[model samples]
Target: MSDAEGSNEITTIENPYAYLERDFSSENFKIEVKNLPKFYGMNEFRKLLNEKLKLHSNKIKTTRKNSPYAFVCFRNEEDRENAINVLTNYKWKGYDLQILKAKPAPDPLVKKRKENAEDLHSNKKTKTEEVCSQEEKLKNSTIPYHNVEYDQQLKLKLEDIKKVLKKFGSELSRQNTELKNWIEKQKFLYDGLPCELLDIRFSDTTEGYRNKCEFTVGIDEDTNLPTVGFRIGSYVKGTTAVGPVDNLVHIPESMKVAVKIFQDYVRSSDLKVFDPEHHTGHFRQLMARSAQNQLMLVVGIHPQDLTDDQLSEFKTSIVEYFSVGKGTPAKVTSLYFQKIVKKNHRDDIVPTEHLWGDTHIYETIMGLKFKISPEAFFQINTKGAELLYKAAIELAEPSENATVLDVCCGTGTIGLCFANKCSQVLGIEVIPQAIVDAKENATLNSIENSDFFVGKAEDILGNICFKATGEDVIAVVDPPRAGLQKRAIFQIRKIPKINKVVYVSCNPMAALQNFVDFGRPESKKVHGVPLVPTKAVAVDMFPYTKHCELVICFERWDKISSKQLQSEELVS
Candidate 1:
């Protein structure tokens, strides 16, 4: 039969052995190599397999874009098995290759000739549907531990801190002899620890404890409408879809209501939600902060070529809607408008204009009133913050004769809390606005002993009179999530009066380097006597989430003699 007639006959043939020559058995000769380097040309990859690896391959199949895995086809099963054995866990260009056997690719001609082509198409459809289902699952998985029991979630958080402390202890043991001896001495109080790891503490109320929430304005994948909530993932990964905040357990009901109101307002507005891809449109984000019965709403917009009059009209419409119109039900105490402009760096300051209502929101923690500004950095959980601050203060062990140095003090929350216990409280923050609020907060609470400076802690720590009117200065550092700057760590070490430091870190993994730097041997780059971890505690500031606060107390000790190092006194 001719080729065309043979193809027709194969399509109608019911015999199982029909078209035996087309059975490629490609699966037996193909291997999948994963964990590839992010950037590489196809020719270079082939050369690596052919010349460098001394393994000849017929062809390599890869995605259109740069993928982390690819399939290389050999001529025989022996070569394929050899390739797997050679490349499995093999280090290549700083990455370990994960090699495994791959399934065969269906030949298009065989699929067309087979009468069960519908089955092949059906299988493909099912796989596509499964992929879409997974995307939805990932998009909605904002609160990973929300469904978990509160007790189990707390334990998980505690375990995370324990791991961080354990790794830190190991690093300390390898860094210096004094630190190793110190860890050995402290082993009696806490097992497998460089310091005493205390029981984790948490607030009484765990659910709906968040005081502030920032919601993104973008298209929702589920509803295909404008949404105000969190993004599923990073925008750089092409995931601009915003998931609904209504289902999030950490957000308070007041914040969710505010989100709904703004979402509705944006949907009704003629302008479009700002697209991160094109950087166009008006609405960008909605920030909500609640203090008891009051709620502050800040509307962020991308003014994308809008006229002054148009911007004024847009601002007036939103102010009226939230102030007295349909959004009055939200009882927004403070309303502000901010133009969202893309920044060159993460720390770039963006100003907010008070469109209506109060200029700032107030919160009372530890009986001291704090004035919170829109741009100021405040803890998301209010009740949880009280527990966190309490733990930090306890670890700090403030005394009337000692001064408390509050580094990265936002609005003087921690410093003011320590003012009654310590002789004086000195705070340093980078944000000028937060410093303004900190001074006003001091005045509001009649906290006369505390003084806040407006500059980076590294720049102001040496210049400021931290040693004024005190026998000892305890540095209480509660820096941002990224941890303390190297210069700030250097400055903290240089000060001889700072014998004790209470380091509060929300992200202990990120702050591990800071902790290590404190105990590093004195060098030209790092000066002064080193401090070692003495005690640490975990605070469950964010329940139903993988986040918690870790407070570690670092203290200085005298160097031991070589004779003492050999004696039992070394463990003491």
Candidate 2:
């Protein structure tokens, strides 16, 4: 169920079939019972389900994000799952369905459970306790010692590590060894920013990596400081460069081997690897890649091969991202050969998308390109995205005359989904390339009533010249990992005509923080204050992984009063 759909009081269900019999058409809602078992054939299943639905007024409101179990609200629990018998070994949809006789409302303790889940140390102590026990045994045990003072020495080493991390601007909370074991890093970045010569920065030790490692530095032909696996960077900050994302900083051995293999394989007499200047080859490669990719998309031919289109495509298709090969210069043109090979580096961390081949990017109804960057956000699962869009549409059944604002509109997906159902749609984003792609996608879709702008949502949104009143406007925001920036939330909180907000986020922590920012009592969030959500549902986007996407709908309790708006700061 949606988090905020606190209908601790669901009393009615409106059946669409009855409405259709009364002359209205059943259009938006439909259901399909999946892969039912042979025992309860479709006929019996349908009959049984129909009887169950009848008790619930012939309607079953689904749980938030289409959870696995149906949140069927029967008048009484006794009849909800009265299978032929409790002992009957029957299955539906190829899976056993367990009917839970749950309280009408979720456990009041759920809020507390969520809080407990937030604590990192609740489960951390087990590891820490283990570490302590190991240390104690180290000094007392009689096992032969290559180093009898290993425990003391390790403690000193850990202290040194603390100093190193501190130098690099990191504060490390003591790792609980009792609950865990060996520690190591694949590589760390200076300034915590990824560098021309930076590598992975890991936490607790995992398979394949149980100790510290080192790297050897060398210049490649292109001369860009390829942060190859030769030498591992340290977590100590200010050592070279600093960055915001610094938790990981160790280069794994696989990366080193990969780098060596790449250097050795391309330099054979039969193959020519391009070797440009020493200082700027990497940056040039970076630039050339961007420009060449843009060109490639436009003409569908990469610049690596000056050969005929088919030949060139074939040649570049294999190692395009691994490494660049020397280009052959012809009378009329030049070709560069760089073979980018795919290899596993620091096991857990490696670039996954588009590195090997073409990635299928989603498009808006208007055909704008949803420009996805190597590191940028794109919905990973496909079928899941369609379901999410449908849910959003149901929430925003836009009338023909409505105006919709799509904020942080990645690839312009949301706006395009609503384009045909609305009069005017506007999308806002900060990435220039993504905006360009979004525009392209819009044009591709042949959607005529849409426009997009590039900038922070709050700043650009407040300045949009279009008049918003008298227009049925709905604002849909799908933000990044960090969730909606405070300024954007404040702006959204004060939107004049938009009375509803569909807040989508990949991070629940940030989402909750943003919600508090808008709905909390003292933050001048009065306009945002009314966004008491009617529902919040979590979608399992990453099956087998912990990550989940949350969709929250907040309906305004009241429109912005004069006092809330008069002194409200304009979004930055």
* Candidate 1 residue pairs in backbone clash: none
Residues 1-572 of candidate 1 have per-residue lDDT tens digits of: 89999987755443333323333234447888999998665656887899999887867889854689999988687888888888999987899999989876644333433434455665644332345442344434556786689889888888889899889988877876656766776665587777888899988888788898878898888779998888876543335778787667778888888899888899999999986544567798888899978899989887878999999999899989988899988889999988876632233336888999988888889888888878878888888788888988888888788899899998889989999998899989988878888899999999888888999888889876544577588999999887898778889888888888999999999899889989888888889888888789999888777888999998875533333467766577
What are the lDDT figures for the candidates, one per model? 0.80, 0.42
Best by TM-score: 1
Model 2 RMSD to the real structure? 31.5
Q: Least lDDT summed over 10 consecutive residues: which range in candidate 2? A: 237-246
Task: In model 2, state the lDDT of residue 488.
Answer: 79
Quality of model 1 by C-alpha lDDT: 0.80
Off by over 4 Å in 2: 1-376, 465-470, 522-529, 559-572
- Against the true structure, candidate 1 reaches a TM-score of 0.75
